[model samples]
Target: MGIVLNQSLKNTIITYIGFGIGGISTIFLFPYILGKTFYGLSNYILSCANVIMPLFAIGMQNTLVKFYSQCKTDEEESRFLSFTVLFPLLLSVPLILIGLLFFDDIAYFLTKKNAIVKDFIWLIPFIGLCMAYFEIFYAWARVHMHSVFGNFIKEVGLRFVSLLGLLAIYFKWITIVEFIYFTAVIYFLAFLVTMLYAFRIKKPVFQFVIPSNVKEILIYTFYIILSGSVANLLLDGDKIMLNQYMAIGNIAFYSVATYIALVISVPSRAMHQIVYPITAKLMHNNQHDELNDLYKKTSINLQIVGGFVMLCIFVNIEQLYEMIPKEYSGGILVVFMIGISKYFDLILGNNNAIIFNTKYYRAVLFLGVLLVLLTVGLNMIFIPIYGILGSAFATLLSITLYSLAKLMFVVKRLHLYPFTAQTLYSIALTIVLFLLFYFWQFPFHPIIAIGLKSILVTISYVYLNYKLVISKEINQVIDNVLKKLKIG
Candidate 1:
């Protein structure tokens, strides 16, 4: 328990540092350095590969993590690693060949009236393959319990390279098309680095024996692929659909707002990645009470983290929008919708992971598909009428409904609930603070105004927790840390 909590703290520290670097790259650098269209193109290419990579990888990644942890011997773990990589490769070859064969048709479908961009299509499989293996190798690392390196490589390393790519665009050294192609290379390089690191940490071997039979694994992968696809679609589906119904230009604006609001959701995501496998291990051992404790503590901790971020953006939104083009500010509504949707999920803590790792895992796949249909259904009904806001609402509805359904399912099956009295207290405190700060009419410089607003908000949240909801363990943890540093 101590080790898990420590790992969670270390990973949270690392994820935030990585996100700080990534925030500059996406929020500031992309808009400041590169033109919106080029950023849009770069975003599109990555989104495309994300959709393709999950399916092409054929769910090998999740299978690797779930099975590798269950494997009883080093030999079995080695075999599973090799075996996971094989299916993605085999599936990818035909996918690559098909894209090459029907290049023109594919281009026509994707680009329509726009000039043929199939040259960038080749980069898809190259990237798709790299992404496939990155997940496989990352799973390899995670099961080895070296979660930090793989996470950094995926989230931060790729973002770092893409940052440089945007810088090149800013300088006009590369055309929009060339920049998109470069994204594929960046993903491949990230994967290569992980593979090299894996070799340093442990040996990789190809063996035939894995935890489950090959037939059973293949069957499992087939099901989990949609689970992966639906999950990514919940994030990436909008961009793809936006491209289909609206102009490519629209994607740039939507992406910008999405990127800003997305910054607020990172803490929740970072915590989830660290907490997921631990929840699975606990469930495997029948530790329901421990799992429930984790669910509650993590929910409160993440709300403190995520709620603060959301409030910062909610308060500073007008100023944040001032950084981008006027047209992009249209994403303001989408930002709110997406922000709430994301925070709601964040507040759910490890509910999704608990369900995904349990005997009820297949239920998640059905839920994922349902989310896609809901997103698309709402997009169809709303995009023409409201454009980005409609998509925002549609996506919000999708995420909200999905979260509610999952929350209900987990409550019924696992008998867990993240929405404690503490959650209500946090919400009430945050709202009251926001109203006071927004209406107070501070007569000061904007920088001072911002600083004062932030301080007041923080103080208000602490007061609420102190008066009504501070957990004993959190206080104990704080005292121990202070003591270790010789502080009063």
Candidate 2:
């Protein structure tokens, strides 16, 4: 718990900083500098890459986490690591070859509704390759319990580079087209840096020896690929569907609103970096009681943190939209729909980590595939009728159903639940605060209004949570911070 807290705190700070940079880039630079059309194009390319990333990596990232702790000796560990590194090439090469062989047909299909995607179609797999390897090496670091450096590169370094790319476009150093190409290069650089850092953590002693559980490993990896694809598809599939059904520019609008909503999930993302491997280790050792304890703590603590974020975003959403261009303001509903879904996901804590490490993962993967199909069908039905709002609706519905299914599966199968009395209290607190502050606004500039409102909300939210003692861990964190400030 100490190490989880320590690193999760650092990762939270780093993730917020990255999201801060990304927020600026998304809210200010991207809309103003890149313009809506090219911005959508950029997002579309990345979304496509993300959607296909699992297929390329072949789930080695998650496999490494689930299986790494089982290695009995450093020799076995090295062999397992070697397999994680090299095994993806077996699939990636063939996939890339197939992509090339069918490139023309693929390009035509994707570009039928939005031709702007045609020219950058090649970057999808290229960037997906970079993203795939980055995650693999990132898992390499996570399994070694060295997640902070990798997290920084992932959360901050990449966004900072993209910020620079935007600045380059601003300064006439690169065309938008060149910036698009540079985006792929940025991912490649991130992959390179992560691989090096992972090596620095534990210099890879490459061995070709497959683990004794090769059959088990392969089966896990295969199911994970489907699960991973399902996850990515849920995250970015809306944008990809938007590209198919509407103008490319609509994605930029949707992206901005979704990015705001995305900030609510930052705590979960930060915590998951470390918690995942920890969760894997716990399940591997058959530590059921300890695992259930972790499940409860993670859920409540993340709810407190993520709920605060959601409250701020939801209460201040109107002003935040005011800061962006009016053309993008229609996504206000998109923000609400997506924000609720993300917050719902946040409260589930390490549910995903728990599921992925279990034997029933294959069953869950099948459920996920069915949900993906449902999502696509929903998008096809709703997008044509409701536009980006419809896409958001589809996402919200699918994600809610999927989350409920996962939660039920975990509880019914493992007999572990993530919620307790504190969970109910935390939800009530969030609702009370949201209702109290939402209708009120500072009569000032959008920046000042947001700042003042956020301050008030933060103070109220923290004080109430502290008084309620909704989570002992969270209360302790508050105590430590106050002690450091000599104000407790």
| TM-score against native, each model | 0.92, 0.99
Off by over 4 Å in 2: none
Question: Candidate 1 lDDT, tens digit per residue, 276-368?
Answer: 778878887889899999988888877877887888777766666665667777888788889999888888888877876777767767877
Best by lDDT: 2
For model 2, what is the alpha-carbon lDDT of residue 429? 91
For model 1, what is the alpha-carbon lDDT of residue 16? 71
TM-score, model 1 to reference: 0.92
lDDT of each: 0.76, 0.94
lDDT of 2: 0.94
> What is the C-alpha RMSD, rounded to one decimal, of candidate 1?
2.4
